[model samples]
Target chain A: MKVDPRGQRFAAAITTVVLAAVLVSASPWLLALQAVVFAVGAGAGVRHSPYGLLYARFVRPRLAPPGELEDAAPPRFAQAVGLAFSLVGLAGYLFVGAWLGIAATAAALLAAFLNAAFGFCLGCEVYLGVRRLLPAGRAA
Target chain B: MAPEQVAGGAAAAAVLVLGTVLALVLRRRSGRFRAARSRGVVSAADEAAEGLRLTAEDIGAPLGERATLLQFSTAFCQPCRATRRVLAEAGALVPGVAHVEIDAESHLGLVRRLGILRTPTVLVLDARGAISTRASGQPRKADVIAALGRAVQ
Candidate 1:
């Protein structure tokens, strides 16, 4: 299914806030909460995620319809990327050194901020770059 | 309250500030067409050595009499959708101009050979198939028209 790019950016804005809080507060529980959000986003479809539902219910109703719809695959893949980083961060917070958690969460925060402020989807770009490099990806 | 907490807070603030600066720089530069020779992502020698001309048979599409807007896109790129609209409109508005969209994922060989680093990378080819200019990211309509002007001239 296709998604409204505006909605995706809205979700990213919220994500930027949550990730920033995690980094500044050094809150393991908060990061764990965000990891769950990423899990739902990746395990299920993006439309089924909490932020997606929030955008659909409260935010999207007030805005004009998006000019163009984008394929859900890229954003979905982006969710998976976020989930992976959160997991690494969670591991760092729970078991490893605090520095590891800070670094990982900081990286995720950078990506989220870019999407929120500039509409640049780093995860989506990584998805395309990786696909372009894969040998098996040559076939249509 | 602790000394470590103060240090951590300072570090986090710095990271966010740095990200903002980087995003601003990318925003300023993204989607602006540049001369193919000025591309820094791939060495100019690579493209120069391979020859800058593309054939109709090579891209699996026919060339235009005056100019061709060749777009390399991927399934997951949102900007590619917007870009398709701009290029298609330009192609329709201009005489002897054609817009051809290539799936970058499916054309890995061509993508690598041409040093295409991202989706929505547009290559403006002149009548003889020499790449005149290219841009990575979604370009404005005026810019697309301007690039076409350079190509068809």
Candidate 2:
């Protein structure tokens, strides 16, 4: 199903907050929580994520319906990118040190902030760039 | 705050600032096209109008008589849907202008060849098959009309 672009931005806002918390606290559990959010967004789908639910239930109801709906692949791909980063961050927090986690979460925070504030998708760009390079995935 | 915390905070601040600058630049320049040499299709008389020159075969679609609004979109791009509406309406309002939507995912080679970084990119091509200008993000109706005007004039 097509998704309301605003919903993705809303989800990104929530993620920005969570990622900020992870960076500030250096908490492994918090990074894990973010990882879970990413998993839900990527694996299950954006519509099924908690933030999606929140947007649908609260924010979307209050706002007028979106004029157009966009495909779900890019945002979902973006969610997968977030999942990868958060997992790396969780690993950093658990085994190595808080610094790596902070760094990783900081990266995620940058991307989320871009999406929420500016409406650009850095992760989506990265995915497209990577897709271009991969021989088999070049057509994707 | 701890020294490391201070450093971390500073880094975060820097990222925020950078992202903001990037956003503003992108938003400002989204619908503005630049001078590009098109090897696609253009009559000998219009070589000076080196905008969007594409052969019908190159774009995988027929060119409109007066103008064509070529849009590159991906399934998950939100702005692309909005862009479609603007282009569609603009095309309908103007005589001899057509709107064509191409899925970025399906046309991976085309996207790469064109250096398309984002979705909902609109390419305004004149009747001669030369692209007059192109917009990177959702283009305004006025911009599209203006692009069309530039093309035919």
Candidate 3:
């Protein structure tokens, strides 16, 4: 599916805020809430995610249409990466220790902040990096 | 209010600053063409050893008479699409420049051999198929024209 890159950035900005909040408060419930957001984004699609819906309804109307649309797979893969980090963070907070949770949340926040502020999608980079490493001749 | 809350606030501020600084550095570097090692210095034997020369067969397209804007792109990269438009326009604007885009996903071996780390990686090749300059990430049209000047010169 094609998506507006701006909307993805919008979602990332929201994710940056949410992950930062998870860090400052060290709240497992809030972190869990973000985990669900990631799950929906990954499992369903970015278009169906709450932040995406918010952008579609509220934010997109105020701005010009995107100059171009991009494939949604990379950002969706990024959402899965976020979900992985959030799950690890939840595990850390609920079972392991506060240090692990904080570290994981901080990592996720760094990634989201990069996408939000700079249009540098760290998760997308990782996705491409991993694809580069796979055995050649396979369809990506 | 509390000591812990104060520390949390400070940490949050620190994270924001760090992200901003890192983004600034990356933004400054991204999409700027960097001249590769001077192809003039490399002896014929060394050039053969390095395999820096790409042929029309390797890229699945004919080279331009003056310069070729050879781009490596992946399936899901957003900038690659934009880069295609920019390079195509640039190619068309100049008389002897041609743009060729390769699917980096399908050409993993070639991508690894060239040490391409990201999508929208562009190599400007002169008539001899030697790489003159390259940029990783989306490049501006002006920079591309400038790079072609160096390539064709």
The RMSD of every model to the true structure, in order and in angstroms, is 3.6, 3.6, 2.5
The digit string of per-residue lDDT tens for model 3 on B1-153 reads: 544334444666777899899888877877899987754677756764675877797788999998999999876676787899999988888889989999888877778877888888999999978888899989999999889888888
- Clashing residue pairs in all predictions, respectively, total 0, 4, 0
Q: Which of candidates 1 and 3 reaches a greater TM-score?
A: 3
Question: What is the C-alpha local distance difference test score of candidate 3?
Answer: 0.85
Q: What TM value does chain A in model 1 reach?
A: 0.91
User: Which residue pairs collide, candidate 1?
Assistant: none
**Could you give the interface RMSD of candidate 2 in angstroms?**
2.9
Give model 1's TM-score versus the native structure: 0.89
Clashing pairs in 3: none
Which runs in model 3 stand beyond 4 Å of their true positions?
Answer: A135-140, B1-11
DockQ of 2: 0.47
lDDT for A130 in candidate 2 is 65
Residue A73 Cα positional deviation in candidate 1, in Å, after optimal superposition? 2.2
Q: Name the top lDDT candidate.
A: 3
Question: Each model's TM-score, in the order given?
Answer: 0.89, 0.85, 0.90
Pairs that collide, model 2 = A71-B75, B52-B130, B52-B131, B53-B131
The residue-by-residue lDDT of candidate 2 on B1-153, one tens digit each, is 655456556667777787788888878887776545544655656663332357677678899998889998766565776788889888888899878888776778777767877777788888977767777877888878878888877
Give the per-residue lDDT digits (tens) of candidate 2, residues A89-137: 8888788776777788788988899999877888776655565566735
